[model samples]
Target: MRREFAILAILGSLLLAGCSQLERLTLIRPSAQHRGYTQIAPRYDFSGKHGRDTGDAAMLLAAGSMFFQRGQLDEAEEQARKALKAQPGSGDANTLLGLIADARGDAAGAGLLFRSVADAAPANGVYANNYGAWLCANGRAAESLDWFDRAMADPAYPTPVRALANAGDCARKAGQPVRAEASWRAALALDATHPQALAGMAAMAFAQGEYLEARAFVERWLAVAPDEPAALQLAMQVEEKRGDNVAASRYRSRLQAISPGPTTAPRTQ
Candidate 1:
């Protein structure tokens, strides 16, 4: 789950630096999966839902993590605080709290909380991945790679593919197309159905002017994540490029159906 948010914000910094290469490339907006957090947040604990204590540190940590993943910062912070009250220096609680700070745009505070966990436990893959994501969001992609590596080094990481996909996304942001391709391929080798990897591969193909191939790749991605507006946009663009006006029009109509409004924003890479 933590792997969903790798640290590597190099490309974003490049944008700040006014890198000209990005002008020719499609910029990829981060997907929910790439943001790497999606868990449910329950506001109240029902009486005797289970034998678990409502305020138990572990329970609080889990609920907090879920809330943080779902982007419910207030609930997550509340749970994390309760967990901390029960057991200070909790890695889980600290991670959730840090994530909440990040969502709220408190980079300094989030960095501090993430550091508390990463510094305390170097071998913790989850913390490493999450910290790396934090570093990237703050425009430190170069420094985030090692943290991603550290996360994958641990066999206990629940989802190594997430780290791999995140690393690929970071590579693209850093303007290393070759590295990005390799990372995406690696992710595919691990899990052929990985949505981000497929979508990334599609983006790579589109960048290279291989419209048909890009279509195929993104079609696979759409199968995995049917609701992603970006994928539909890609499909429309790819069909237009391939001279299939009928299909292109169909995709355009679909896009309009899903997201009603002006369709004027330039598509991202």
Candidate 2:
């Protein structure tokens, strides 16, 4: 059961592509809640050669982004590859390819691609943040912390929340509990109910054997996203720790019913 819980956590982190502080905050409010935030109609600018030429590299890149947004991983990858062939070393192309690789479960490939971009453009905060996130997810917590630092140092980085959250996660993985707690607290100050911050807190509590605290964290998470698979699995863990075998079994069955195939395991405590 512990192994299963760990695997589920890892899988949950992987499935959430943009695993940064800002991205986690974005998930706090479902799309329905966005209605209360701000709404804007889609806009397109089409007044260039790239617009006229369907096979143009820029156009292909745009198309790839659209496909990626639509969850067409194969199409997005193919288009991104075509763009890269036309313009080798293009940052946008490389980033798109890396995202496609990540979507297809190739974390190493994605990391390599993003690293290449970071090597080429050391000042690019986007590359730094993305690579740092990949490193953290792949278990290189110490190395990821450096990249997160670089991202934070860049004034042009639009999302400071993401960099801080990622750094905090790396700190937590590196066993710096106090620093991790501080980082998460900072993230919560920016956006209360941030998913990753809440989830990370729960994970930390579980690691420390504070099952009730962990349960409370996950419960709050579920209050916002009741059907979140990770939350459901964590709830099961809490139930098991509380000696509620029947409840735990029910959660396990629900998880199996939702994702029964041979899927990747969750994160470890």
Candidate 3:
């Protein structure tokens, strides 16, 4: 009886230890519930399976978006092309192709593709927003703002805060600091814990030499995304600028540890 009791106690303790370790692992992992952004791309549901072409262009476009998100640019492009072939004026297909092109560093091609889609479906808030973001990234701030406004005006738009964030980025890049601040504040009003808006505000504050404000925003970002490299780098810069040498050094060490090493030099001729 004594041996049996001892064995049961050991098993119970081992189970409890396993549970504790599992809890710790779950805490450290990124959770979908906490993430504000949608999944990079979602899978498509094609009712007809592999080869049926019953006018399911939307499914093809969605499949392309999923492929693009998974970093399979070639497959994404193929799917997008098939979608376009099935429906010549498919805004979603063109948008997916544009995204794939953009991801593959073909900016000009992406611009052309996005422009065509936006022209075809002027009322599609998603297309307008995506095109606007592309324009903002390409330094066409004025044009981007126009598209953002168009997107925001659409009552059917699901993610207005995202469009507002893009508009804020355009305003910031265009040197309209006051407007940028207002747009970012509006985005925060929509989604108080929006990471992109917070990060943008932090960057603006840092540019103005406001290290404390920048640090606060960066801390918020870290709270949401502890391992984000860009946020980590910015936090280190802020700490260094604020004369927190010890903190800065710690961050620098972390950055060095996480960053990839430089490539070796090639042999001379």
Spell out the clash pairs found in candidate 3: none
Tens-place lDDT digits, model 1, residues 111-152: 898778887878767777767766665677667778888878
Better of 2 and 3 by lDDT: 2
Best by lDDT: 1
| Pairwise TM-score winner, candidates 1 and 3 | 1
Candidate 3 vs. true structure, TM-score: 0.73
How much is 18 displaced in model 2, in angstroms? Answer: 14
lDDT for 222 in candidate 1 is 81
* Span of 10 residues, lowest total lDDT, candidate 3: 1-10
Candidate 1 residues lying further than 4 Å off, grouped into runs, are 1-55, 63-72
lDDT of 3 by residue, 1-269 (tens): 00000000111111112222211100000011211223233334533365335455555665665555457778777777887798687555666666566556677897898788767768766667767766766768777889888878977665788778767877887778888889888998999776667777888888888999989987887777666556677888888889998997776666667776532211110
lDDT of 2 by residue, 45-161 (tens): 323333323555666666666566567888777777776677676666787787677677777787798799778878766567777877777778778878878876877655567
lDDT value for candidate 2?
0.64
Q: How much does candidate 1 score in TM-score?
A: 0.77
Candidate 3 ranges beyond 4 A from true positions: 1-55, 260-269
List TM-score per model, in order: 0.77, 0.66, 0.73
